[model samples]
Target: MTKDPKVVSFERTPAYLHHRAMLNRRENNTIDALELMRHAVERSPENREYRLDLAELLYEMGCHEQSNKLLLDLLAEDDGPSECYYGLALNQLGMSDVSGAMKSLKLYQKRDPNGPLLGEVARLAAELTLYESMNRPVSRRLYRATRIADRACEAMREDMPEKACRLFEKTLELASEQYEMRALYAMSLCMVGKVGEAKRNADLAAKGFPPSVRALCVCAQVYGILGEDELAFEMIRRIEDEHPYETERRLFIYTLGEMGLDERAADCARLALQETPYDRELLHVRAIAMKRAGADDRAVAGF
Candidate 1:
């Protein structure tokens, strides 16, 4: 039950006339927001509220130069709101003008002593403190943990298989149960040609989330990688019958292709492609199977 578009437009128009910038931001209509506020500011240059709203909108839309100028003018004429100071501070931060951002932040703190943004301000302050301390000689335990994980992720990204495996070994000493970290660690081991350990971790993850879509898909992939194609196909069949969504079916089709069963893979890929014509990966498999079957023209067209 969607609402009538006409009714929605009519309701929004009146509210926008009063709080044009705020409403435009809520709707994510940046261009119309700029237009509406731009016109209002030109017509009533004396209206500080309209000018400030326009400035905030400009800041949100990444027009920092215009936004900073408008905020400066507003601050000169009147004591602006806490949000105004915060907006200006964020704009300065984006511009890498840290000194200006600090000044604005101080002003915001003074004006909004009991404002709702106190928690966020505290979090940001903590993050800034951590960022500043990242280069210091004194090593905190949390910093060490973050660094170990960081190196592991970087090694995987850079394709340094042995380094990634060593880093993951270090990470396991800190947090063994972190799913994403464990997943990456497992993948790195696999890439470095450690099939047994990768299978062990993948099996653990599969057991942890039995019947889950992602876990099942990963298990299917792991089995295929381990040359247990029959077991992988069995898992795929179960998942497809139990969860008939496009995601499961798609994984099942890809598993067949990964196992080199071109005929059966082609059948599944054809059905999936019919329903989701724009799926690039599915199209790739279809093209591969077509080429294998000596249908070069169809494969090229599919690609």
Candidate 2:
């Protein structure tokens, strides 16, 4: 018997794959979406839209360098869409290349003054201008330092703690006052068995009044790693006192989980869930935290 047309096997063309990728992305299946998007791009190497879409997915996935390269290649095309410049600017920002981002933004504005992303472009431009004016002479050095720190963060995320440590050290050499970077450097140091140095950096980061949520979280992790429970708890307390935003709250919860404070993580996640009822990520985090804390029934309900 013949299968229904809808159930028949169709040729997986580039367009089909691209559409499927977008659907997967909408469903939050990012890994599968990326794979499908890659296949689409590979099959349609000459298709600018496919390439642009792939680059955008890469950018969203934190593959900044890869996305930037693709965007740059698109920008080199005489007939490329002006959107390439806007995407390039975003990737540049992700890489902490403030100057490069500014240049790309200018190009984008010149090419498409009435683009759909004009408002976003203008907002980013205004923010960058304010950032540069605030720091003035030291802005350039800070930007360079931030670029190194971004590399360090990528290394950490890739599980290359030693490389991250080296890059963070270089970042600190240029901008020692970057408490967040220092905190991350401390975490990297601890990962690489440099407990003493980690403690020193973490202590320094914690010294900043009203420490950033990232700094507090990293310092807490470093202290926990060093068996300094008191200090770790102190950092956690500070995080609670700061009235952190949603992103910071997520970080705080994850930090608690990292320090093996599952009950606290669960509690924090529950509190955050009350604030953001529809956040799938918060629900997932809360489920995991609850599971780890042995609240099996609540965990099951959460899932």
Candidate 3:
């Protein structure tokens, strides 16, 4: 029997697999997406877009070194996209190569002055410049505190709130002015049933000058967990008044969900999705929010 033309075309073309991989990623099926993306890359070895997508997925999965190597290989090609420099900079930052990241950012700006990522590139460049300008002792202390805070964040993600609390305490001792970390510390405290201490830290973080989005979100989460709905809503209002980045917007959505404002969270997620329709993380957040709000149809469609 002869094979069907559609089946032959689907089997032979990498674009179908690539498109499917993107859809799976949007649904937060990262493992399946990774496998599908890998197959697509294998089938179309010379396709730079496929390889770059694979590298970005690897970075999202925390395989920083692998992503960096792939990005480096892409840059070695004379006709590589200027976007590779931005990706390289991200991977370098992930690996703690601040100097290298700065260099890559400069190259990216030089090559693509009108790129879509101009805002992100400028923000990252300013942050890197601030870090580099710090004196050696201050820089070292901040780096140490950041490393401890990273471990604390990992502990929180792993559901070890007590461990995260201890790590955050150590981090605060080294960098006392990091109100964002203090807010996160408050969240860990709340997670472990230390409501009084959590409230204290949250209040202090909320009082910090020029409140940051993450600090506000963490404080809101702590207040919500402590049954202080008024304070929590105020924090959410403050976040809304600010022009937060995508990650911060995600945090705001999560804080709303944590406070049982599922419908509001879904609305915010939908607004964010309108800006970056293909963002897998935002899609995942929106799906969860819609599900919680009893919008089964929309939630199912998202997934």
Candidate 4:
């Protein structure tokens, strides 16, 4: 008689899929990793670790709204693991909920005062107070638009893209001529997956009152998403040549990184570091670019 071989069933376990997802992430195959993570979550809805992994992946993919929901739900139960607070705080920061982020940071501190991430939370909390506060309404006609736009921005930062988009529409209704507001509304449209409208808004943005650097960055992002590479590159050029402010440069670098333009991102990081060698964020981007370009493991650690 021939010896019988043991049989294995890959479909029987969520862990197998989750492991594959992790491998995909390691290889930078984000689309496959995201889909695999989703399938793993579906198969094991009660697995806290699996949910956390999916949420982390979503956050990395810029789906902060969904990630925040998963993290918040996880934290609602017993909080033995201090990482939940840290993850929640980071998610809140991604969505621009600075107050909420700070609150979560405080919770993280309470849970684990010596947490490695406390430094990042503290830095964000400290910086929240120093933003260039948007000027208040100087005209009665613009007051309602401003209020709605502000609420929309708040919603966007809270990871409520649909709410933000709705609020932005109302803002546009009240002040159709508000170019800056329109640009923001365009971004909201993009968040909600209305790419065509976003592109139209981007086109309209160029004609109206000069847009803020942020608007240009957003427009470029929209163009990139729509596969209009030329327009996207043009927008980036405009940002670099026309708007060379420190804030603008950082935002530009961030946009390039998000676009997955490894060479350009590395170039921007290199140039930016020459000007501000101490900028940790640029250093981080440089490391990411190095890793994406298949540099040795030590390349990232050097940053």
Best by TM-score: 3
Tens-digit per-residue lDDT, 1-303, candidate 4 = 998999986564799889999999999898899889989999998898999998888777656667878887887777645777777777777656776776887888787888887787677656664541344466666798888888999998999989998998888888888777777778788888888898899877755645467777777887887788999888787777665556577788788877777778787888878865544566888999878877789867988
RMSD of each: 13.9, 8.1, 9.2, 12.3
Error (Å) of candidate 3 at residue 57 is 11
TM-score of each: 0.40, 0.59, 0.60, 0.52
Tens digit of per-residue lDDT, candidate 3, span 1-303: 987576433364699889989999899998899999999999998999999999999878756667878888888888788888889889788657898999999999998999988889999999999987773345788889988998999999999999999999999999999899999999999999999999999999998879799999999988988999899999999988996766688788888888889888888988987865645566777788778788868445945
Instruction: Flag regions of model 2 displaced more than 4 Å.
Output: 1-138, 296-299
lDDT to native, each model: 0.69, 0.87, 0.87, 0.79
**How far in Å is the alpha carbon of 13 misplaced in model 1?**
38
Q: Which ten residues in a row have the lowest lDDT in candidate 4?
A: 128-137
lDDT tens digits, residues 185-208, model 1? Answer: 666777878898987876665555
- lDDT (tens digit, per residue) of candidate 2 on 66-174: 7878888987888778988889888788667888899999998998999998999999999999987886546789889989998999999999999999999999999
How accurate locally is residue 239 in candidate 3, as Cα lDDT from 0 to 100? Answer: 89
By TM-score, how accurate is candidate 4?
A: 0.52
Clashes of 4: 1
Name the weakest run of 10 consecutive residues (lDDT summed) in model 2: 275-284
Please give the ranking of all candidate structures by lDDT, highest first, separated by commas: 3, 2, 4, 1
